[model samples]
Target: MSTIDVVEVQPPALWEAKRTKQRTVVWQEFGLLGIFTDQKPKIKQDGICSQQLLSTTEKSGVMDSVGVPGPEEYEEQHVHEVYEQIASHFSSTRYKPWPIVESFLQSLVPGAIGLDVGCGNGKYLTVNREVFIVGSDRSTNLVKIASQHQPHAAIVADTLSLPHQAGRFDFAISIAVVHHLSTPERRKEAVQEILRCLNAEGKALLYVWALEQKTSRRGWDEGHEQDVMVPWVMKTGKKNPNEDGSMEKTFQRYYHLYRSGELEADIAAVGGKLIDSGYEKDNWWAIFQR
Candidate 1:
């Protein structure tokens, strides 16, 4: 009979001091276990010990086994969550409808069925009251806010997959929407979806954030990531009882800034003919026919 010895090794004094209440214990009989004090675990996988060390870093917010999000997921998270969080504040600021968009809306025939994709607060839906507009948004809260604006119909739907029959709408408008889509494929799909819902001779307007914007203070010549996060500051008028609430909270939103001719290219990619396309007020606007 062979006797095995069990030794309880104490972690280094440096590691012991940094250990928090949250600790992950791995039991192994024989092997050199490398525990890092910098929150990054360097584990050796060979011989008798084949298990991997699973740890999380608080400072970096990176966790093991939890997969990182792709661009699409990050876009969805920011678009959905940020809008939901700031829906009230957003509705308050979006009271005025764009005159250019209103002029386009007026061009539609009276009693025409129109689709307002990604309609936040339904500001544009109120335009051309003669045309019965059906508003749809990805954010449920914003949809609810839009419902208050008295659209003919309000539905929660994704831009990529609109909840409408083919050729059901005489016209469609996707304002400030396509840029939220993370990938080119998704942006194309959204345009295709709008075209699918419109009649064969129908026309649609699409708007996206422009790379050149005076308000953004981003230089046109400066190199920047196409996909970026913009912050929205939330105002809380009253100070907290416990502490001074002078610090305003800000929410970050995902936006895919469009370069010159990008909007037209996206429309052309979806088999739509671009009637007109240009930049206006920090956004790229395009009118297309299906």
Candidate 2:
């Protein structure tokens, strides 16, 4: 097996070491810290970018109201920034549409206008050209790829604060998006944001990673930590020993695995009436209406 293609669990020691390593690369690469190595590092994938989008030598030092790292700050460092960096590689592996989400999109009526909250790479955008869909995500790079679907649109926007007007969309889908929120409040607010865009009778379908995915390779069970960092290992397929000789890199993305019935509880908390809900493919999905 090629060293670059190998996908194994990262050793805890090495992972911690890399996590706290000196930020030799400019702090602006991700606005906080980054690592540049002169040699290739072993890559590992715990589960599931090409440019320094923003660059500077100093830290951004962005913090929440309390002056310490809060939910937004934590997500920016672990979720948003990581997605921006690995958008290309992440998009490549996410082309296959989940069966449930596909059916949801296909079932939409023609001429219907909908929102795809956190539509990474907009794979579902191609599902139904007959219905107009506006896909939005926080990562600009992923939005760029999502915009390639004709007749559909993608924009860079946070899930917690969507730009659309209230109660305008016919439907909305937030597959694999809510799990990225680092805290319960943020996650519920994200669901509320989706519901806010729906008409009084409009519906929304949301999916989140499940904490009970014991059969999966990750083996996350009920007792496992619900809030954790999952690594996405990308093989760049190029070697540049002279500069940053990183043939591969691993990014840690934040996720809050939903336990059984947790998704329904969130919907209820957001005042959304649950229409239908189920578990599929290591994920919890719920279709609800406002």
Candidate 3:
């Protein structure tokens, strides 16, 4: 079993870890995605914030055919660690909010308290200032950048084990997040967690990569392996070019592309009532209520 230890840090950085041996698996070099920045909350690098320590088994991020690590360990390497390493670069490219997600936020009522459960760089947190949002992500680095968004908060947290109370949030969004889990059971569990955070009438939006995007650049469509490793190439500065004159290092992250009806199926499996759902820009999105 994995345990999370919440430690309060007081320093030049709020909730920042200062070299702790809490990770069951040490940080490893890997390529992953990033998120955004805007707004300035009452931040204090010298103030107090909380850090969560996730203890899970170790696994290399490399793809292999045999002896595959469990979902927790696999995600730790292929997902969380990669995001931490590429937070800045990832955030730089992720500024634009998806139209579907943007519309969802704009539709919310004023003063609505919500959660962005896998809230990378917190680009959505900027969508509706009339309402309040608490964003959470597994990457501490991303959370720090996301924390800059004002009238909102960001914290280091995992989708499967959020720090918020159940049935408390008015709404929630977990965009482009559930696809990162390596197993069907884990993906369903992720949906359950999202629904768990909602009030009786609260709605949650979720997005996942679609398997039927033949028109997209990746040209992935039906019949392609749903479970696959996608590569992210991070370009280092010109000062670090390799002999091939390429200054890029590629890292692979695992994704389980959702076919049509899959997102709704997962929501239904977890006893959530589907409010709305559709595909947009190579992803399947759904809004559901608990």
Estimated TM-score for each candidate: 0.74, 0.77, 0.76
What tens-digit string does per-residue lDDT give for candidate 3 at 148-254? 99999999988999998999999999999999987778899999998888999899999999999867655567865576555567887799886777677666566
Tens digit of lDDT per residue, candidate 1, span 1-290? 13222222211111222333223322222322323333433333322221222235462323222554554566667778889888889999997777679889999888899899999878897777788988998888899988876537778988877889999889999899889877778889999999999898789999888877634333322243455555566765566321443434555566778988888998899899998988788888999988
Candidate 2's C-alpha lDDT? 0.75
lDDT of 2 at 167: 90
Which candidate wins on TM-score? 2
- Report lDDT per candidate: 0.69, 0.75, 0.75
Instruction: Please state the error at residue 169 of candidate 3 in Å.
Output: 0.6
Off by over 4 Å in 1: 1-66, 214-222, 239-244
TM-score of 1: 0.74
lDDT of 2 by residue, 180-234 (tens): 8866788899999998999987989999999888677665678655665566767
Residue range with the least summed lDDT across 10 consecutive positions in model 2: 22-31
